[model samples]
Target chain A: MTPRKTDFPLDQCRCHLETGPIVLVGSQWQTERNLMVMGWHMMLGFTPAHFGCLITAANHSHRLVRESRECTINIPTLELADAVVGVGNSDGDALDKFDAFGLTPASGKIVSAPLVEECYASFECRLVDDSQIDRHELFIWEIVKAHVDTSIDLPRTLHYRGHGRFMVAGDEIDRSADFRVQNL
Target chain B: MTPRKTDFPLDQCRCHLETGPIVLVGSQWQTERNLMVMGWHMMLGFTPAHFGCLITAANHSHRLVRESRECTINIPTLELADAVVGVGNSDGDALDKFDAFGLTPASGKIVSAPLVEECYASFECRLVDDSQIDRHELFIWEIVKAHVDTSIDLPRTLHYRGHGRFMVAGDEIDRSADFRVQNL
Candidate 1:
């Protein structure tokens, strides 16, 4: 089911990404478009909403994102498990993942890359640094805009554990009382 | 109780870390030793067992790791939740985290940095690239040796969310049958 999403605050992006769930990265350059499942990513900074992820040059989406200098980071829930697995296993070059996986593509506010409408959240990102691309295939991006389905209080996100295994985002433990105000 | 750990295969380190659990980073240089809770880390390579993490220079352990060029990435379970929060909230430079939190500091086989005996796993690491450190405060390290408690088939790891909240690692979904052999 496609979710009705609202604009999200850029600084609060860490709240959603820091936990590290497997994301479907959407990319497009002129006529070519693709989606790749990525797990190796981390929040770099909060103010500029910097995010870093490794996308090897071997992937079909690599060149598209490199040329476009933009992409969409979409957070899929447990319901999209099959699509996530399918996207990761198949090559994006030969397949139209959006059509094959039955996912809806929505136009982004800032980036040309399409966002997956079925996802719980989608962040439109622009590449901020390309220096590490040649050496590490790491793309540093600044999230320009974010859209989130805030209705889903606790989205059951998928976290990849390699070898075709995954761990679902589970019960929340609120330890706010234990934390220092400054730390929080 | 501290579980007895055996040497783990370096190539399969992704199985444990790719899931993106918050880890306790251990570092020591001369008389100064510190522990910092780190969530911004990712696997870079398998053969050389490369791992990349961001440690801003403001962190006390950052200087220790930078000077010594070594650190230990320790994976703690839900059992050590308080210790994890304590280490993160308090200043590492002023306090002995291991002693204060009642975590045993075991000597590493390869690196001078001590490993937390209470953790489910500990990987001794050596700094591989310092080029990004000055520019991004990103440290690239190669896992020299890894130790894991194989007895625990499933570890309840803590994934940090902002505002002192956490998501405990949950149920496993094994879709190995659905996966392509090469992709798996």
Candidate 2:
């Protein structure tokens, strides 16, 4: 690998950190359960705990999201990297992704939306507001509960680029110098 | 540093990417051109051209953005990372971040927003739509052009995890075992 590829480490890069698509599993209109890929997702905090995500107005997930007013944000394990694009490029409007991908869903204790069985961590949220932007919607919510699979405490991770490509997060680096570089 | 400290990447594991602020530096609202640090942000795609991002409602840049109807999504560099936090934390309601951060603004060709002086790359976007989500309004944009500092093709990047934390993007890894990964 070249120097750039060799130095590719997820822990060291800040931009790649919070920019991956995880499975957003939730029930649509309360009864229909759905899962869509969201690279626009991120956690707002740890204390009160919050997560924010952007959804397009044209997408089916947005419709489902609006009716239920609840959802689950799952952090994908390294192994789920390929699955991320697989699910994201495809749409809930056309296919039954759960059955197509052989993915499983389970109900969560914290929120009404179902969680992806394969994901490592799940955040159950109650809608904070329904804000609009041109064609996309921003759903800010308060995290009610966080679920983790102790088995996959540490999994390989993936960050989204744009289209269908994803960069798997690898390696960890150390900061020997402080903000001033000479401070260390 | 402990191994665990270097374990999960700040980019991938930092929960604060959602809350960080950014200044959308544009030509000028009255005297100048376009730009705005949209706190209302999110990612929309992965390839063909990897795309995703958010646009906030309350900033003055939003108006320039409406006039130009396009802006670049600049992932902050390490040096301006704090500016990201400062911009996000401070409201367009109170003060102008561009002046505060000392970031230079340059006019964009196809779009309206100006280029942030210290940013790594600017994804020039065209307005996809400006729809309201529910309460907080958002603008959906599709990036049409990308301007990068040719010297550095954006190897590392920055992310806002809400509040004051920012994470730079890490390296890219091809974890796909085979080309068929997409087909699966």
- Give the per-residue Cα lDDT of candidate 1 at B25: 97
lDDT (Cα atoms) of all candidates against the true structure: 0.92, 0.51
Residue B129 error for model 2, in Å? 3.7
**In candidate 1, which residue pairs clash?**
none
Model 2, residue A153: displacement in angstroms?
11
Could you give the interface RMSD of each candidate, to one decimal? Answer: 0.8, 8.2
TM-score of 1: 0.99
Q: Estimate each model's TM-score.
A: 0.99, 0.57
Candidate 2, residues A26-57, lDDT tens digits: the string is 55465566787665664443345545677777
Off by over 4 Å in 1: none
Indicate the worst ten consecutive residues by lDDT in candidate 2 chain A.
A1-10
